[model samples]
Target: MSRKAYSFVRGFSAQPARDLCVDRHYLLCASTGALRLAAADRVWLLPPARAALIEAGHPVRVDLPQPATTASVLFDTAFTTPPPAPLTVFDLSPLARALLAECGQWGASEEPLTAYAETLFAALAAVTWRLAEQPSPVVLPAGRSPLLRHALRFTGERLGGEIRFEEVAAEVGLAPRSLARRFATETGMTWRATLRRMRVLRAIEELSAADTPVTTIAHRVGYTSLSAFNAAFQELTGRTPTEYRASFRP
Candidate 1:
């Protein structure tokens, strides 16, 4: 019988211009930028301090619309234990971050990689075990009503651009006002509120390890003015963008 191998890699930067398809039980830690993973049924948002696990042989499209740096590990199903959930999003602990950094340094050392991978799995499993004490993970369900789905998809595509009611409504075949009402009914937030939340989530990902200026991050996430972005960021996160970045940085 052919034996399967454990694999680890660093610095994965999958561009949004092309679809990145993978065929392994993959786990990834993104240091910067919002990482979107689209599997057959669900889409996961991978932000800093959060990680994603994808099952083996599952088709997934990994999208990072902006530049991002990440470390990933792949396990061939023939050799590794799989997560109970098909796809899982879990909080990254400080120890988990340290483990990932050490794993990155291990490079192509197969024995060390295997050791680290097994330890990583144990840590992740421990986290899952503690879910009874922790809050539920941040995740969004994919299926939605036809009009609602189209509008949300349009909003996601235009995250850094202006998301207007007129355009989204037209694309979804609903009047702008009716669409707004339905969106709130379905998602429990108004269109503008939802857009702001999405923008802030994207901003948090960019703020994770950016060497760029805050104004640039603001512009990159679609705020026209620095002040507006600051207020919005603070409102959503209870800390300004600068403060959030500082907390993450050593």
Candidate 2:
């Protein structure tokens, strides 16, 4: 059997993007900018000192404010023990952060680094599961409009498929003009802008997973062609799919 790659990225945030799951699981820490995850009727807000646990096959939407820094780890599906729930925000303990920092500086030493990283990974998973068991306050946007909520749910369900404004408007029983206005008013973003973020979030999951090819992943996530996918991925991630995969090697 082929071994799955584990991905790690640590850098300053540039802009907001969307990510859809491929096969890998993601653990993310954002020093600034908020991260949002929406699954069906559920939408979550991850603030500082919190990390988001994104499961495979779930479509997540992310938004980063002006400037932010983030550290993320992508591991194979097999590596993740089942969480009590699909998504949870956990406190990134001091030890978890320190270990992640050490892993960042481990360089090319596979021996010691691998062992230490595994330990850290275990601790991270435990913390996330523990947090999931405990109820944390959930914050949903105040006065969220029905149209915006409908759009978000529609996006999450169809992350791997195509989406059009007209289709979304029809689903929500609104005209295109009316839907656009409602989206902006409730979500603080245009329908197109929200769709773009949703697409990027789906792409992140595809890029992080092991079995999917970049071209296929791109098409699956709504890019018409490979070039478009590459451009979008680079714009959001600062690295190509191949380069990102290499960072995750175990």
Tell me each candidate's RMSD, in Å, in order. Answer: 4.7, 13.5
Q: Model 2, residue 96: displacement in angstroms?
A: 3.0
Per-model TM against the reference: 0.67, 0.49
lDDT per residue for candidate 1 within 41-65, as digits (tens), equals: 4556676656676666666677776
What's model 2's overall lDDT? 0.61
* Model 2 segments more than 4 A misplaced: 1-7, 10-17, 105-113, 141-250
lDDT scores of the candidates, listed in order = 0.65, 0.61
Candidate 1 at residue 76, lDDT? 53
How many clashing pairs in candidate 1?
Answer: 0
Model 1 misplacement above 4 A: 1-7, 17-24, 39-43, 75-84, 102-146, 156-164, 181-188, 205-210, 219-228, 234-239, 247-250
Query: Which 10-residue window in model 2 sums to the lowest lDDT?
Result: 134-143
Candidate 2 per-residue lDDT, tens place, 147-250, comes to 67776778667867777889988998889998888876776667766666556656644444345777787778788878877776666546676665544332
